[model samples]
Target chain A: MATEGEGSGFAIHPMDQFVIKPLFGGEHVHWYTISNVTLWMALAVLCIVLLLVVGTAKRSIIPSRVQSVAELVYGFIYNMVEEVTGHDGVKYFPYVMTLFLFILFSNLLGLLPMSFATTSHVAVTVVLALMVFVGVTVLGFMRKGVGFLGMFWVSSAPLALRPILALIEVISYFVRPVSHSIRLAGNILAGHAVIKVIAGFATLVVASPFVVGAVGAIYGLELLVAVVQAYVFTILTCVYLRDAVGDAHH
Target chain B: MATGTETAAEAAGHGGGHAVGMPQLDFSTWPHQIFWLLVTLVVIYLVLTRLALPRIGGVLAERSGIITKDIAIADDLKQKALKAERAYNDALAQARADAARIVAEARAAIQADLDAATARADAQIMAKAAESEGRISEIRAGALDAVTEVAQDTAHEIVAALGGKADAGSITAAVAARLKE
Candidate 1:
């Protein structure tokens, strides 16, 4: 696999596409400089605007195709937040919908022939998971004061084990953001990498058709993962918010 | 398992210039990724909060309102139609009863007229019979008078012709006694 710049070798470079090179020629990536990541994220935003805002501009009772799509998205995110978080959690529906839509659009768009999968990066997903983590923590403290610390305490456990159980619970509680972000990034990254690896073998004429067919199968699975990951993230956020706002259960 | 392969492939290549590791672990690109992600997500959040969600909510509320109004109108119309139907049936029954009463009244009036006509006809028939009986009785009386007068005159004529004395009072008495015997 270490065949760098070896002219006659048929080596595959899957990570080359993920390099954060500037869109302009010969310029290194800067904080403000536009890059492929900036372009794609903007595109995701554009898509969200088109689907959610522009699509429903007409507000027709008998919805057109775009309107139907907009309504379905609206109802889906709305119902999910309402059901998972309950009435108190419903106030944060827009934030949850925004998170769900952004991730969903990014995952779907990342599947393009040549595009960046932003959600596949830890930098992006960790920020999102941190936002949820920090927001829920702050809300819990604000609403319940010192009682919020009771979240880590296992009250029903035997007194001898409660101290040890609380330590584990606190550690696990802090690890939520790490696992949450990693789960999404890992799923997206692996699916795309497998497809690219399989597609690189397409240059060989003997196994090209079979490999390409397998790529297609993987593509179908990736599509499923794309939507499912978004749903998982949003539902987890709701569950955490419910825990933060709801009565203590454990 | 899959990340190992991806990282291994990345690590094996490009030893001199910017060695690629696990992309998720690559610290160089984190700032770029995080900056753009924050910008994009914040804009998206604002769009949903200020524009999209509200617009969709309005459409839903408007549709529900229109449906409720239409249902209310339909219910009102149904009640009105039911009331009209009830009134029409009642009027129809009243008209039938009225028609029956009119037929009975007409029949009774006709019976009374027929009875009056029959009574008038019976009175006329009784008067005509009584008048005929009176005329017959008068004619019998006249015939009886004529027979008595003729018998007396004949007896007087016969007595004179036979050369015997004719007495008017004695002839009358003898005729009457012979007629009685």
Candidate 2:
């Protein structure tokens, strides 16, 4: 927010891309105002439906390319959910899969030139992270009841150190959503910002070629980060859900 | 970056009510973004649960079921084929056994016929031999009688020629008694 790359004749304002404005000609945003974030998010769902629903309309034993993709994603999520959370947690597979697909699509689609990244915005990611946090917490309490609190209560330590460990555990447990949301957003935000910074350096006459090359290379790395961040976010959700169903805490 | 964006915004004549900070930090759009996110997530969830997931899961289960049923049917057919082969073998063995029994009966019947023919031939040969022996005896008797008469004549002539006392009847009786003994 403090740096200015306007020393050269070309004043490249990379952070301007992150600005959220009303889709229509309006100075103020309303609750129902159509925005770029809304458009991209809807597009993500459209892609998902097209891929999953339309692709598998035939449901042939021998899958078409579209059906293959849909089934592959389904099986991938199904196996991950089963492995991380066990069969007992598979009942919630649809919800977890939905979240994973939505985030994955958002991250990948955000990589398009001149496109907005939904996952980079805390407003978007916080809601997703909070959903997992709340859902898992509710499930934990419902399934394990008071025993769920035992996660924070360390039993294997000396009596004096036990309280300190328990306090630390409690703080860390509450920090799950904060870190979960911020981790994805921060990774995406940092990558995009770095690319913008490198692109802005392309305006320099002497360093133009190197800066452009570096930007291209960073774009490739950003693509990997896009998928990896989504994977990490999803697997972490599965791990938390496992704690809920299995209650490894106690 | 602040002055640069401001200068750029000024150059574009897009003046913000307050300096446009990080668009993500803009609280005014949070409601818009969050509201849409919530709506979209709910929509995605409903779409998946209602349509996409169940369809995909159903296809998988149906494929598995088809494969399992096909395997079971194949197994059933294989078992039937084995049963047919076993029945065919039993029938083949029965036919071989029947053929052997028939051959054995035919040989026994032929042997019985051969034994009867041999017995009849031996009886005929014995009868022929008896008849021939009877003829020979008769002929021998006739020859013996002739020889006795000749011996008697010779004896009588010798007695007459030598002028000695000799009887032809006595000589013939003695010769006949010796032949009988």
**Clash count, one per candidate:** 0, 2
lDDT by residue (A57-136, candidate 1, tens digit) is 99998788998899888889889888887888888999999899999999999999789888988889999999999999
**For candidate 2, what is the total of clashing residue pairs?**
2
Kindly report the docking quality category of candidate 1: acceptable
Off by over 4 Å in 2: A247-250, B1-21, B77-181
Q: How accurate is candidate 1 locally (lDDT)?
A: 0.84
Model 1, span B75-137: residue lDDT tens: 999999999999999999999999999999999999999999999989998999899899999
Clash pairs, candidate 1, are none
Off by over 4 Å in 1: A1-11, B1-19, B103-181
Q: What are the candidates' C-alpha RMSDs?
A: 8.1, 8.8
Specify the poorest-scoring 10-residue window by lDDT in model 2 chain A.
Answer: A2-11
